[model samples]
Target: MKLHPVLVLDRTYTPVSIFSHKKAFILDLLNKCEVLQYYKSIKLSSPTMDYPAPLVIRIPVLLRHWQSPTPTRRAVFIRDNFTCAYCGKIVKDNNATIDHVLPKSRGGTWSWTNLVTCCNECNQKKGNRLPEEAGMPLLYKPKRPSSFQIALNRWRNKINREFLEALSLYGIIVDKKKLPEGSR
Candidate 1:
């Protein structure tokens, strides 16, 4: 009795609702919307019906807009590859936690630049102290997460032929070319 999940997006490209996968697919075929992914199906039924209906989960297509990624604990962990910023070790199995480079009490706000993924041990030891105060240095400088990058990350694992084709229409694709020196 697995159920499919769906993500609904508003006209402005913001996530607004989630629906059954079957409903999403139907909408896509009817030209009412676009499909983001085809997730596992779930059995659904009406109270008055004897049999269950199968549904698949999906995300709605959105209009293109230049927007920045929202800052969140999950986003930070993904952006850092679940690795501790100070120790450079990957955190897994529920051992990862979000840390602030500058303690919030010391005037740090919840933003991507000030937040990072850290192991429980590091977070506990670095409590309320700046990295420098704890003799720790960040392996990478943090910056606001990019919306395009976040979108790619979210869909990378689930991408398929149709998804790739659709994304390509928006100029999104994987490139292996090396940048010329001094380009940055």
Candidate 2:
């Protein structure tokens, strides 16, 4: 599937609204919206109800902004690159789990600053124990993922060349050079 260029908010990476190819063309000319990534074309039924047309789409300009680093298991794992915070071992997405720097029982609250991604083994070994107690320490402090980072993860499967270029203009650098060989 081909990607359609979409516009996302400058720092927030939130979808404001969607634009048709015709609309995107005008916005690109007017500089009101910057493109992020292109999504696959979708067929929409014609207003006359007899036919469908494939059209390019883009993110809209009026999206809501919110805080970053929403603390959730998936978000933590993605933020930590699916690697165990203590050992640096990469884990599969499904095998990743959230670990607390400070155990909940010891007054820890579920927040981005206190959570890290871990493998099952590390989680089991460190269960309910403070990092110091478990003889483990995080390689880096945990924090919320940026809006751009979260949005990139969400749209990775649908991104295309034009979208990548557009996002670059907004300073959302995607490290194409570091992608694993053979990875899409």
Clashes of each: 7, 12
TM-score of each: 0.56, 0.63
Winner by TM-score = 2
Give stretches of model 2 more than 4 Å off.
2-7, 10-64, 156-161, 177-184
Q: Residue 68: error of model 2 in Å?
A: 3.2
Task: In model 2, state the lDDT of residue 104.
Answer: 89
lDDT for each residue of candidate 2 in 40-120, tens digit (9 for 90 to 100): 433334576522222223444433454454677777776676779988898998788888788888998899888888889
Candidate 1 regions off by >4 Å? 1-27, 33-66, 159-184
Q: Give the TM-score of candidate 2.
A: 0.63
